[model samples]
Target: MNIAVIGLGLIGGSLIRALAARGHRVLGFDADPAVRATARDAAARMPATGRWQVTATIRDVAADADLVVLAVPLPALHNVLDALVASGFHGLITDVTSVKGQVRDAVATRLTGAANPVAGFVGGHPMAGREASGFASGDAALFTGCAWVLCLDEGVGLDDWLTVAELITELGARVVPATTEEHDRAVAAISHVPHLMASALAANAAEDLLALTLAAGSFRDGTRVAATRPELVAAMCGGNAEAVKLALAHVIQRLDGAMQALEERDPVKAVRAWAAEGHATRGAWPPDPGRPEEVPAHVETLLRLGRAGGWVTTVAPDRRTVTGFLPVSNA
Candidate 1:
């Protein structure tokens, strides 16, 4: 497939390398001239994986490309789409953004015109990243074993969704189909809130010499993603503010209860009672993702699999079936 990718940052650059390595022609573009030069120079030393080049302009990236990946930050999505719209790119488009709800709305509004009523836009968010940014940290192996989300909203075209899913599964990541709303809510409870927790933990311990010295695996691991760039974290948390707010309410309530428990007469018993569910949840830290199975690659089945904590490992090339992992409810 001929593919064009915008924003040659870590995930974007990695997408380029991974797809090209799999023999897909790729053309990538970055706003930063230095990053563009770096990618071009780096692509030189790597063995010929597939045919790819760094385009001089965003407009050029869409020319004759089968798929165009918008890997830019959340706030920049509109501008990128506008550029693509102006350039008359009617090919299949997907994104690697953290937030999906906003992207879905934007695609529906901007890309759906009378001339192109059936816009092949499938909102995507690859649940993979690094604390580091730029094209320098990109690795084709970054997405291996990761969960790549492909929005499965009602209006999403089946063929378009399958095409994006196929590309994601080909890159060695499991495709988790979900609605834009479900995807946003799930990610807020999991990814966004966790990042906030990590930030708070790090902030509370900063400049305290003893706390820093005594920090072990628990503290270090808990605060790992706190090392991510601030602007990037802000965009992620801010872009999905409504969902994040809803998720934060539950977290705040639990924390308030825990604090109240600490002040009780029988503090130990109270605290443990307050934390029983949390303990069980933490103990199940990477829950068994269930066994893999092949199923018809229909939207209803994919959504059912996702709601059951399952993911699609492989989609049949003809879009008729998929090999997916259907997770257990209590394993």
Candidate 2:
């Protein structure tokens, strides 16, 4: 496939490497010249077998491509799609935006105008990333062993869906279908809300140097994702407001129950019951009655972060449960 990848950041760079490795021609485009340079330099870090190209303008890069993978920030997706439509470029379009409902609505409004109707736009979110951002930090293997969600519309043909699935599969990911509403709700509960909690916990802990000094693995582990790129997170939360609000409400309910348990001073049994129930809810996850695959490993981590307000794990691979914090949630 001839593919044009916009954004050239973590997700885009990783996709470039994956597509090129599979012998597909990939053209990279980014607003920042430095990022374009970084994408070119990535070939040395993660060498690819097929030809790769980079450009500054989205039009030049996407003009003749068979597929366009928009890996830009959530807010930028609609504008780019509008430009693509205006330029009379039609292709199978997909995106790596975290929140899909808003993107879907935006495309419906902008690309489906009487002037140009978008016939092939699919929303996707690769449930894989790191605290690091930008092209420099993107790893070609970032999506490896991860789950990638693709929200398909009836307009998208099976061949187009399979093309995107094959690209993701070559990147070492399994593809799952979700509706825009389903994708937004799932990400709000699993991804966006947890990021807020991580940032809050980390901020509270940052106040005292002495406390931070005494902080061992627990504090470090708990706050690890707090280091995520703040701007991107902020945009994601703002874009998916209602769903994230619902997720936060759910989190508050769990926290309220834990607080009630603590107030009664029956910490032992109370915490145990809380952990058990929370773990069970997560353990039985996938909860997506449609996806046949098991929940990914990071799902447990996200659940742990949401339930405990910080990272806490005790169960080891040796099969023994530790006495202190909590057993690792099926890690």
Candidate 3:
């Protein structure tokens, strides 16, 4: 495929390497001259047979491209879409933004004219990233064994979705289909809220320099995400503010319960049980080996029940049953 990747940051640069390594011609573009230069240097070192270059302008990158991946920051996505539309790009388009709702809306609004840049647009968020940014941090292996979420809007055709999914799967990531709203809510609970919690924990601990100095494994691991770029964190959390707020509220309620339990005459039992629950939950995270779970025959029914605020139980291939909580109602 003749692919163009906008924003030669970690995700974009990595995609260039991965796609080119898989023998796809890749043209990279970045607004920043330095980033483009960095990408040029990096592309030179790849051993793929496919042609690779760094385009001087977005039009040069988008022209004659079979697919274009927007790996820019969340806030800049819409503008990039506008530029692509203006440049007359009519290829398949997808993005690596964390938030999907805004990006979906932007694509629908901006890429609609007769000469619009996109034949189809799918909102994508690779559940893989580093705290680091830029082309220098690019690694083709970054997305290996990771979950890549794809949000196909109503306008996107099945063939377009398959093409995008095939490219992502070729890069060694499991492709998971999700609605924009579902993707936002899931990421809020799993990624956004945790990032805020890490930031908050780090900030609170900063007040006591001596205590921070003595902080070991737990503190280091817990607060690791706090070191992510503030702008990226702000965009992610702010873009999904409502979902993040709900996740945070649930966390606060849990923490309040833990605090109340700590005040009991014998707090160990209460605290231990709470901690055990989390430990068990974390331990059960399914191992990812580049394949997604099989969809059940009654998947749509299960999803409808979940959206209607019902508790869901999944019976394993064996007789074991796994129960999980669902939102009382869709947000």
Candidate 4:
């Protein structure tokens, strides 16, 4: 696959290396000269089985690219899309942005008065990252075994979605199909809210020197993502603010239940009751996906699989079917 990845931050740089390592011709561009220079210097020293280079311009990156992966932050997505449109290059476009709805809307905005608004745009969010940022933190294996979402929203071409999914599966990530709304809401509950909780917990603990000094496995494990760059966390969480707000409120309600229980007459029993719900939930750290089945290559079926917490491990080359696994849905 001939590919171009814009933004040489942690995700973009990692994507570039991953694709290039897999023998795909990848062209990378970063708005910052320092980042481009860093990648260029690394390209000189690091030997890979495949080919990739740092381009000076977005237009140049798009020129030979069959698929363009925008790895920019949410705020810069529209501008980068504008540049892609201005470059007069029209092909498959996907993104690694954490939020999905905004990307879907941004592409839709540009596609007004078109024959097919959602034909080329396949909203994507790889459920993978590290606390660190920049090219120095690039990891070719970052996405290994992660859930990479490819939004199967209405009007998205199955072929386009499959192309993106195939690439993701090649990177050793499970491709999960989902609607834009579903992806946003689910991620808000899982990814966005956790970041907020981690940050808040770390910040509150910082006020007490004794707490910081006494912090151990529990605090370190819980607050790990608090080590992430605030700007990056803000961009992701803010991009899906409405969904995050709802998820955050839900979490608050749960905490309130536990807090109120602490004041009950039988505090021990009340607390135990509150903790049981969480204990049961977390005890199922991961549900068993029994086996892979061939699902018909259709949007509705794919989305259903995703909504049920399933993922496609492989896609047939002919696009007739996808090999996927789905957890048993109680609902």
**What is candidate 2's lDDT per residue for 1-331, written digit by digit as tens?**
7899988888888788778877888899987898888777766555547547897788788888888888899867767876677667667788899988887777777666567755577778888877677887776688875667766555555445555655675676745555677678888988899889989888997779999889889778777778887887899899999999999999999999888888767788888888797788767654332312222223333233323322112222332221112223342
Across residues 135-207, which tens digit of lDDT does each residue of candidate 3 receive? 8888888888677877644556655665676688778775566667888998999999999999998999988
lDDT of 1 by residue, 105-190 (tens): 88888888785443588888888877777788999999998988899898888898998888889889988999999999999999
Instruction: Give one digit per residue, the lDDT tens place, for model 4 in 1-331.
Output: 7899999999998999999999898899999999999999888776766547998999999898889998999889888888887787777889999999888888888854464332388889998877677889989999998899998887788899999998999899999999898999999998899999999999989789999999999899889998877887898888899999999999999999989999999999999999997787777757777689999998888888887889998889899999999875232
Measured on C-alpha atoms, candidate 4 has an lDDT of: 0.88
Provide TM-scores for the models. Answer: 0.93, 0.79, 0.85, 0.93
Which runs of model 2 end up more than 4 angstroms from their true locations? Answer: 41-49, 153-159, 280-331
Note the residue pairs that clash in candidate 4. none
Off by over 4 Å in 4: 46-49, 111-119, 328-331
State how far residue 44 of model 2 sits from its true place (Å).
8.3
Whole-model lDDT, candidate 1?
A: 0.87
Stretch of 10 with least lDDT, candidate 1:
112-121
